[model samples]
Structure formats: structure tokens, C-alpha cells
Target: MIQVLEVKTEKDIKEFIDFPFKIYKGDKNWVPPLKNDEKKMFSPHTNPELEFCDTQFWLAKDNGKTVGRIITMINHKYNEKVNKAYARFFKFESINVEGGEQLLLFAENWAREKRSTHIHGPLGFSNLDNQGLLIEGFEYLPSIASTYNKVFYKDIFDKLEYQKENDWIEFILYPEDCIDERILKLNETIKKRYNLIVNSFKKRKELQPFIPQVLEVLNQAFAELPYVIPFDEKTGSYYIEKYFSLLNPNLIKIITNKDGEAVAFIVGLPSLSRAMQKANGKLSPWGIYNIFRAINHPKVVDLALTAVLPQLQRQGVAAVLITELQKELIRYGVKEVETTGIFETNTQAVQTWKNFKHIQHKRRRCYVKEL
Candidate 1:
């Protein structure tokens, strides 16, 4: 018999976090998240989102062996903003269809008890968290910001009668193919026409003051996107502290208008997928060495985020930002550029990517089911 148990004890929490390590074993493309990071995410003291969200973790077991894990959440803030009673499921992993079904059923029942009318996810407390299920490109290694899973995991969602709520697509770009003489010239013209200035940083401290303004632009830029919530002051600070140390200053670019206010920004990181895999979810001496090595001599870069102020959309600000970042990537001798998820319906963003030699190789999905 299969059994689903709430993760209430310390041991249960460890099992919940460790379950994926077992499921993805021997899968060359899977990247393990840092174990310390996983622990912090579940703690209320560390993850500010826990202060406002109702959350629970669960483990599915058969014959006393762990088979699966899942998390159920209700973001009261999100529900109030969208004016809908919706719950979310995230960090879902399972060894087989049966284990997946049991864990999902438990989550559904719990959501109903909480008075939610519909449930959707592979989403998390906020957009900053990893969201979506891998629906395609299983053979390719996922970026540190993307999601990955066994192909069979989709079958469980199908059997549960869940339908697609949204889809996010990812791409791999060749910087050589993306560099265009016309765009470079256009960037110069656009900068002169709009009186926009591009800012590049060589040190983390130099980028600190602009952080708040960049996040404000990010809030305004993504306000209309699905599953978005604005970053409150505390939340923004938390993220800054969490990720600021990992960023390479050379990979960040910002654009300011004549008034010197940040209106657009692009953030990239040296691809740490291989390094994280080498770490095997631990920060051992060797793991720390591998991470620093990748940071210092990166060949692959992940374009993690780009945001343009709402009023500035279609004004070529984005193009200018990309051109500046492209120059830096070339200087770094970068070979491959991986993008985080872009919603499939975002035609403008999709078209922007097609300008380069690229492959829309990966797709992730958020599934929904009415309770």
C-alpha cells in the first residue's frame, strides 16, 4: 500500500528535500540544487514568503521506502490580487505514476479543506522561485534557474486530468550569430535619440545603489505577466542578499535615461549547472573550488533576467541593453547563451530571440485542475 505523510518532523523535511536526489539518479542532464539553499527555503526565518503563505510538505512512501515528495501552498496575497481562490503545488517529484498520484491527491484534498476552488502550479511563493514542469528538452542540461524532471512525470499530471494553464519556453543562443552590425549601429543611434546611457559595473559595490531602482523597473515591467507579485521591500532585500554574492559584475548591464533613472537592465550569470552537479548539492572543499573556477573562466552564460520599464517598451531600450551585454559576452569568450523561461504567448519577446541563431529547445508547463 502507498501512504502519504505530512512532513512535520526534522527527519521528514530532510527526506522531502532528498527525495529528488534519488529520482534523478544517473540522469546526466539533471542539476542538483544546493542542499543548504533547499533547507533555507523551507524555513520561515530565512524565506520571507513563509510569513504570508500557507505551506506544507509531504512524502509518499511504499513499504517504508520513500517514493515521492510534494509541497502545497496557498498564497493569500496572490489570491487577493487575482480575486480567485487558487492553490499551488511545487517541488513535485516521484518515482512512479502511483506515487505521484497519491501525493497529488493528498495535496488536492488539503487544498479543498483550505477552501480553494481551483489549484494550479508547479509554481512557488513568487516569480523569483523556480516554477513550471519540464515538458520538453529532457536531453539538454537545464540552467540553474530552470526546472528539469523525468519525462514520465508528465504522465502523472495527465492521468490526474490536469490541463495546461501556461507554458514557458527556453532557448540556447550563439552569441556570434546574435551580433548584428545594424543592431550595434541602431543601439548607438537609439542611445543618442533617447539620451539613454548604458551602465556597466566592474565591482559588486558599484552595482549596489542601482539595485532598488532595477527591481522597481522589474516590478513595473512584469506586472502584467502571469503568476507575478510585486516585490515588497523586505522580499526584495532578501533576494538581494541571497543572490547578490553569486553575480558576476561584468555580466550585468543597466540603461538610464537623461535623468539618470534606471529604466532597463539585463542580468547574466556564468552557467553554474555543471558546477552544481559537481558539488552534488553540498559545499565541500572541492565543490567550492569548482564553483569559483566556473565563475572566473566561464564559457557558457545564462541570461537570467531582463526588464524594461513599461512606458519604454518597444522604444528600443531592450535592444540597446542586449547589444551592450552581447559585447561583454564576446569579450568573455562565451560560447553558449541560455535563456530562462519566456511565456509562449509573449510574441514580442519570442521574436526578439529569433533574431539570433537559436533553438527553442526547452518547454515548461504549469498545470491546472478545478477542485
Candidate 2:
């Protein structure tokens, strides 16, 4: 018989965090997440999101061996905004099909007890967290910002009768497929017309001052997006500290208006996928060195995010941001870039990448079912 138990003790939490290692042991495409980072997300003192969200983690054991793990989370802010009680699952992993079913049923029952009317995810505490299940692109390795799982995981979700809530698509770009000349000329024209300036920094310290403004712009730009809940001040600060600190200054480009307020921005990280694989998700001396090597001499870059103010959308600001960032990426000898995830319905964002020779290599889906 399969036994499901809630994560209670520190030992249980550690097992929950480490379950993926066993599940993806020989999978080259699976990038291991840092254990400490995973732990921090579950700790209320570290992750402010816990204050507003209710969460439970579970481990499935058979014959005293952990065969699966899952987390059920309720983002109250998201529910309040969408006016639907939703309980989301994240970090779902299972070795056996039957075990996966039991995990979902356990979460569904828990959500029902909490008065949640529906269950969804493969999602997490916030948008910045990795969300969605990879339904395609099993060959390509996932970037650190994305998730990868066994192909069979989709089959399990299918059996549970979870309908698609939404899908996010990913694209891959090569250096040979740079922006077209006409777009470059258009970007110049837009910059001159709108008094837009693309800002570059020489050092991480130099970029520090603009971090808050860039985040503020991101929150505003992404506010109208479907299923988005704007980040609170504390949550915003938490993410800024967590993510931005690791970015290479040269990979970030911020667009400002004549008044010097940031109107648009794009951020990329030297692809650390291989480095993470090498580090095995540890950040000790060798792991830290691997990351620094990837930063200074990266073979691939991962486009993390791009955002523009609603009023400035389609005013050529998007094209300008990409064009300017493209030059820097080339200078750094970067060959290819993987766009982490773009919502399927984000036509404007999707259209911007169409100008380049690219492949829609990966697709991830959010699954939903009535509780």
C-alpha cells in the first residue's frame, strides 16, 4: 500500500526537497534546484508569501521508501483577485503512476476541506516562482528559471481529468538570427521620437540604484496580465534580492524616458544550465566558481524577462529594447538564447520574437480540475 504523509518535521521537508534527485537521476535535461533555495521558499520567515498563502507538502512512501512528493498551495491574494478559490500544486514528482494519482487526490481532498472549489497548478507562491508542467521539448535542457519533468508526468495529469488552465511557450534564438535591419532603423526612429534612452551599466554596483524602478515598472506592466497578482512591497523586495543579485550587469538593459523614469527593461542571465548540472545544485566553492565562469564566458544566454509600460506598448519601445540588448549579447560572444516562458495569449510579446529565426521548442501547461 502507498502511504501519504504531510511534511511536518525538518527531516520531512528535506526529503520533500530532495525527491527530485531520485526521480530525475539520469535525466540530462533535469536541472537540480539548490536545496537551500528550496528550503527558503517553504519557510515562512524567509518567504513572505507564506504570510498570505496556505501551503502543505506531502511525501508518498511505499515499503518505507519515498516514491513521490507534492506541495499544495493556496494563494489567497490570487483567489481574492480572481474571485475563485484555487488550491495549486507545485514540485509534483512521482515514480509510479498510481502514486501520482494518490498525491493529487490527497491534495484535492485537502483543498476541498479548506473550502477551495478548484485545484490547479504546477504553480507556486507567485509568478516569479517556476510554474507549469513541461508538455513538450523533452530533448532540450531547461534553463534554471524553468522546470523539467519526466514525459510520463503529463500522462498522469491527463488521467486525473485536469483541463488546461493556460499554456506558456518558450523560444530558442541563435546569434545568426539577429534582428532585421529594418527593425534596427525603426528602433532608432522610435528612440529619437520618444526621447527613449537605453541604459547600460559597467558594474553590478552601478545597476543597483535602478533595480527598484525596474521592478516597479515590471509590476505595473504585468498587472493586467491574466491570473497575475501584483507583488506586494515585501514580496517585490524579496524577489529583487533573490534574482537580481546574480545577474551579469551587461546582460540587463533598461529603457528610460526623457524624465529618466524607466519605461521598459529586459534581463538575461548567462545560461547556467550546464553549470548547475555540473554543480549538482550545490553552491559551494566549485559551484560558485562554475556560476562565475558561466557569467564571464557563457555559451548560452537565457532571456529572463522583458516588460514595457502599458501606455508605451507597441510604440517601438519593445523593438528598441531587444535591438539594444542584442548588440551586447553579441559582444559577449553568446550564441543562443532561451526565452524562459511567455504566456500563449501574450500576442504582443510573442509577436516581437517572430522577427527572429527561432523555434517554439517548449510548451508548459497549467492544469485545473474542479475539487
User: In candidate 1, residue 284 scores what lDDT?
Assistant: 99
Local accuracy of candidate 1 as per-residue lDDT tens digits, 210-243:
9889989999999999999989888888888867
lDDT of 2 by residue, 144-215 (tens): 898898888899989989999899999998755455788788888999998988999768898877878887
TM-score of each: 0.97, 0.97
TM-score of 2: 0.97
Among all windows of 10 consecutive residues in model 2, the one with the lowest summed lDDT is: 174-183
Which regions of candidate 2 deviate over 4 angstroms? 177-181
Candidate number of the best lDDT: 1
**Residue 6 local lDDT, model 1:** 83
Model 1 lDDT-worst window of ten: 348-357
Can you list the residue pairs that collide in candidate 2? none
